[model samples]
Structures are given as structure tokens and as C-alpha cells.
Target: MTDSSAPPPAPAGPLSGLLVADFSRILAGPYATMLLADLGAEVVKVESPAGDDTRTWMPPVRDEVSTYYLGVNRNKRSVALDLKDAGDLAAARELARRADIMVENFKPGGLRRFGLDYESVSGSNPGIVYASISGFGSGGGASLPGYDLIVQAMSGLMSLTGEPDGPPYRAGISVFDVMTGLHAIIGVLAALHHRAETGRGQHVEVNLLSSALSGMVNHTSAFVAGGVVPMRMGNAHPSLFPYEPLPTADGDLIITAGNDGQFRALCEVLGVPELAGDPRFARTKDRTANREELRPLLVERLKQRPKMEWFHELVAAGVACGPINTVDEGVGFAEELGLDPVVTPGEGDRAVPSVRNPISLSLTPPSYRLPPPALGEHGAEIRAWLAEPTTD
Candidate 1:
């Protein structure tokens, strides 16, 4: 057997000394805490004996590990605790009481019975930054399970996706859950900063439905300001023409000619300068109004060239354009652009790569220090820590 008394490894990033008790399951909560872990936080993921549900959500498993589980769970330790058991519940509470931050995605009142709720833990650990993520708000919607699909359906997001005449479609990815997790991270960081200043903490709440609504950007604004519920326009932009993905000889290319100058440049590159000056397409509003008449012309021009050919020419001409690529292609493209999109976790095999956090903080860049843990892998270590007497 390995030497169990070896010192825990030192952290590599700025959040080196922070301890995070992650009592979340599935995507959103785990994702938020995983991001913190990536930045060098000591995240102790508390799972039920059955493990995170995503561990079983797979057809794509690597070495018997579910891709769904691997994707959001990097750089953390795991400790299984059956909260239903009094001993386990006490251990979980102790973990919370000692942690710098506590993250949970339990349904409203779900952990109250075990006294693991934020209110209960914060009652003693007043400095704990308690973050709760839910599907919807914890008010009237507290009891509802916050699935990404359900939130996408209720947040009017589905209605604004897909083709104009096609049924509402969910985004291929759980974008709402991802966004909610990101929002939660932002809130937690902000709360942590506040705590550092005042030596006090407060509850931070994030819900998928609210996050989805906020992420709607101008779509939600249009509805609120003008009573215009945005409808799906396929790959087209509601306010801009020639801003949609067009089919080319080889594949689809998105030509994002957002402004008049880009429109002129795009038209020039397409060998259709006259179209740029045409009375019907001279300005954004004009182009938007004349989209039906102009679309066929643009599509015909685009079809004559391969996507890469137009992509290169348009980008050279100062018009924003590129191929519509799949996830694999997107990752490769980011790599080509010198983004260094992937990072291998120090503790994981090559297959379990962690994507770098998009935020680039010059003073404190996020780092991938540890791979995701096996289920309850840190149970004994965490239990030992919890069993120690509190000094404060």
C-alpha cells in the first residue's frame, strides 16, 4: 500500500490555500466548483454513494469513465457521504463549517433536514461564502428540479432557436446550465472578495432560468421594450443581413458583416460591389428590410466559392467571416489561433484534458492543478479533517 501520511500536494495557482466544500451534483454546481478547483482551490466534492448522476450518463466513456462526468469535474477530490445517515450528515456539516466556501445545487430545502443548508452552516461559519445553484429561483420555484432542458423550455430560449418554421429546438449543449454555473462562479468570487474586506459572508444564489433570461441579451430587451417576442430566424441575424451562415461550394460559412463598412468590404470580396451601393441595401436598416431580395443574390455568390476561399478573402478584406465548424474543429481553430484552449490536468491521463478558463487574468491566471477524483476517493482524508476539533 502507498504511504498514507505523505503531505498533500502544494497548489499551483492563486487560490492555493482556499478550501471549497462542493455539495453539488450533476452539471451546474459541479461545473462552478470545478472552475474554482482549476484555479487551485482545494475542492472537496461530496457525492452520494451512487456517485454523481453524470457518472452514469454515458455512451462515450473513456476507460469506463463517462465523458459527461469527466468534462466538468476536473481538479477536485471527492468524498461520498450519505446525508441520510447521522454520522455522514455530521461529517458533511463539519466539512461545510470548515470550508472557505460552500457550493450546493440541492433543491430548495433539500439539505435543510440534514442541517447542511447554507443558513444552518453559515449560522456558525459566518465567514463562509455560501453559493446555491438551482434550476429556477428558490422562491416559488424552489421545489422544482432545475434541469437544463426544462429551463431552456421555460426561459423562451427554445422559442427563439432553430428555423423560423421548425419546432423549438434545444441547443445541442446544455448552454443554460453552463451559463448558470459561470454566473455562480462570478458571484462566488465577488462574495469571496467581499468577505476578505469585511470578514463576513452572504448567500449567493444562481438559477438556470434566471441566467437564461439574462443571457438572452437583446432578445429579452426586444420583448420587454417593444413587446416583440423574437422568433427563430435560422442562421440569420434578426437585425442584420448577410450576417448568417451561407452555404458555399464546400460547406457553410458565417459572414458576419455587422456594419456598413464590412458590408461594402464583403460585397467587394464577393465581386458584387454594386449590391453594396444598391438603394435597397445601402444601410443596415435597408439591408434588413430587403433581406428577402438580397439573400438569393448573396447565396448564389457564396455558392460559387468554397467556404475556406471566401473565409480567407473576406477576412483579408476586413469583413468578419469564417466557416461554421463543429466542436472538434472549433477546438482546433482555437489552438491554431494561439489560444492554447486545452490543458492536461496534472493528475489525469492524457484523455482527460481540461479546457482552459476563458478569463485571462494577468496577475492570477487560472491553472489546472489536479484531475477530477474517483468517487469518494478522498472520503477518508476529508473525514479525518472533519473529525478534528474546531479551534474557533
Candidate 2:
């Protein structure tokens, strides 16, 4: 960790002048704050002495530090403050008072008693963008904990996941937590725009349930607008034929023939061009309705080649197709395509690998200024700055 008792240099990105006081731990708030930090905001991560819970979440460790914690905490300074202590509380208050943005993920109204909630902080810095994230809305669900697994189960996501009749499974990643973080980012940016125009800040709120529902776009819309309750189809798309993985000689290859043209091409590739004109499979609706019958004919041809061989043929035919790749293979594929999927966020020996931020700007690209901080690694510097008299 950089152990200097001085503030870091000014950021050079689009959000260079912004200061974010981050009173969040775990995934959602930390993820949003990390993105802000990448955009050149100065982020001060406030934590209790025990530190972020993810610090102890292990099994995957890099240099003995929790990878889970490191993954979302780059480009930030850490300050450990026990809120129960008057001096620490004062320092936290000072940090919040000086910040232009504040983000927290405590349960609804959890920070009110500590005077760190939106109302309290905005009372002094009226232009601060205050963002709060929760699992459910702060309305009737305020008492529930904001666990991603619970949100996945409650948000109807798990219902749509898994093998058709098998037990529902949570996603390999905390999908809703990630979605909530992205939503929080959107809310904060919008609030910043509003503040720039009106010279006033407003509270920005995001919750996991709402983000999850919004993310289930096609599924939810099918029920609401079309009165169709969708169920798991075990990797099959409900409306499109040949949209699921098909067996090859060696493995499975996902093949999507989305239109009549693609269907004709696929039929040609299969050496059964006449099948494209067969009345039973002539159109999308007909193909979908006769999928059970059409499946075996396509399967018989696909089983003649290996997955990657079939993958190339299908792609060349202007049909979308690929073999499902493992995470390592996926990253390798991105690298092969010049996407540069991984990056190191710090200078010299301490640098660590990070997923490249997805956004691309013609100018003002995101930067990697700081490596993930160790627990209170910048405590001395942060506390010293917080002790100084505040102009705000």
C-alpha cells in the first residue's frame, strides 16, 4: 500500500474534481464507488476496524488478501474509523461534510442515528449527491437483509434459471448485486446532471429487487404485456427455433437461426437445403411449432462434426453460433480478438490484474490510478486530512 501522509495527486479523468465518501462494504456500493474512482473521483472508503466483510471472505486469495474484496475496491483510499468513538465519528463526519458525493448500502434508515444519512450530510453540503442501495425498497421490505442470494431467489431469477425441472440455482455471480451497482451508477450520474443544472442535489436510491426485475426485461414483459408466464426451458429460447445448444460429435454448440434467411443458410450448411422449404419448418412460427420434429433432422447432421468445426461453419454461414467457453477460455478469446479484457491497476511491483472497464470514451478514458487498498492502508493519510479544518 502507498503509505504517505499526503493526499494523492489530482485526477485527470472526466470526474477529476469529484470527491466520493464511500460508507459501503461488500459488493453493490463498493462496486459503484470503484467505477467512480476509475472515472477519476477521489474515493475515501470508510470502514470499521473489522474492515469490509469481504476482506475475510476467502477460498480465493491473492497475496493473502481476499480476491472478493480486491475485485471491487480499486482506486480508493481506506480509513478505518470506529463510529462509536467520538474522535472517529468526528473524522467520518468531516469526510462526509467535505465530499461531493456519498454512497452507502446500509439497511433503510440505518445511518440516520449516526447522522450520516442523506438528510444529515446534505444539511451541511447541500450539493452532495447522496446514493443509497438496498436489497428491496425502503418501503415494506426495509427490515429484510440485502443478501444477493436471497434477492436472486425472491426476484424470480432463480425460477428462470437451472435445468427445466431441477432445483433452482443462484447464478454463479451475484447478478442482482452487480445490477444494483450499475443502477446506482446510473442514479448517481443522473443526480449529478440534475445538480449541475439546478445547483441542488437530491437523494438517489437503488435496490436489488428493482434492478433484478428491470434486468429480467423479456421475461417480465412477456407476463405483463402478453399474459404469458415464462418457465425455464433448459437453455432453449421460448420464441426462436434452433436457438439452443445442439449436440456435435464431441460437445454442444449453441446455434441460433433467428430468421428465414438464417434458417435457409443453416439448412444449406447441413446439406439438406430442401428442409428449409418443408412446410413444417418454412417460417419462424412453423419451425417453433414443429421444433420437436425439426430437431432430430438437424441433430443428425450436427452430430457429423465436432463443436468447434461446426461453430466455424455456422458463423461463416452468417448464423450466430459458438461453443460455450469456460472463464479462462472466454478471457483468452477476448485477448485473441484484441479486446484486452484484463488490466493492472497500479504502478510497478504492486500492480494487480483487473477487468477492464467496459465503457470507451473518445477522450477521458477510465484510468487505473490506485491498486486495491489494504485494510486502513491509508489510515494515517486519510485521518490527517480529515483532521484539518474543513472549508465546506
Candidate 1, 109: how far from true, in Å?
Answer: 1.2
- Predictions in order: lDDT: 0.86, 0.90
lDDT of 1 by residue, 308-359 (tens): 9888888889999888788999999999999999977754254367678777
TM-score of 2: 0.95
Clashing pairs in 2: none
Worst 10 residues of 1 by lDDT: 1-10
Specify the poorest-scoring 10-residue window by lDDT in model 2: 1-10
lDDT for each residue of candidate 2 in 1-392, tens digit (9 for 90 to 100)? 23553335544888988999999999999999999988888899999999999999996998898889989999899989998898999889888889889999999999898899999999988999999999898999999998999999998988888899898888999989999999999999999999999999889999999998899999989998999888888888888999999998999899998999999999999899999999999999999999999999999999998998878887898989988899999999999999998988776667879888888766888888778998888889888877777554
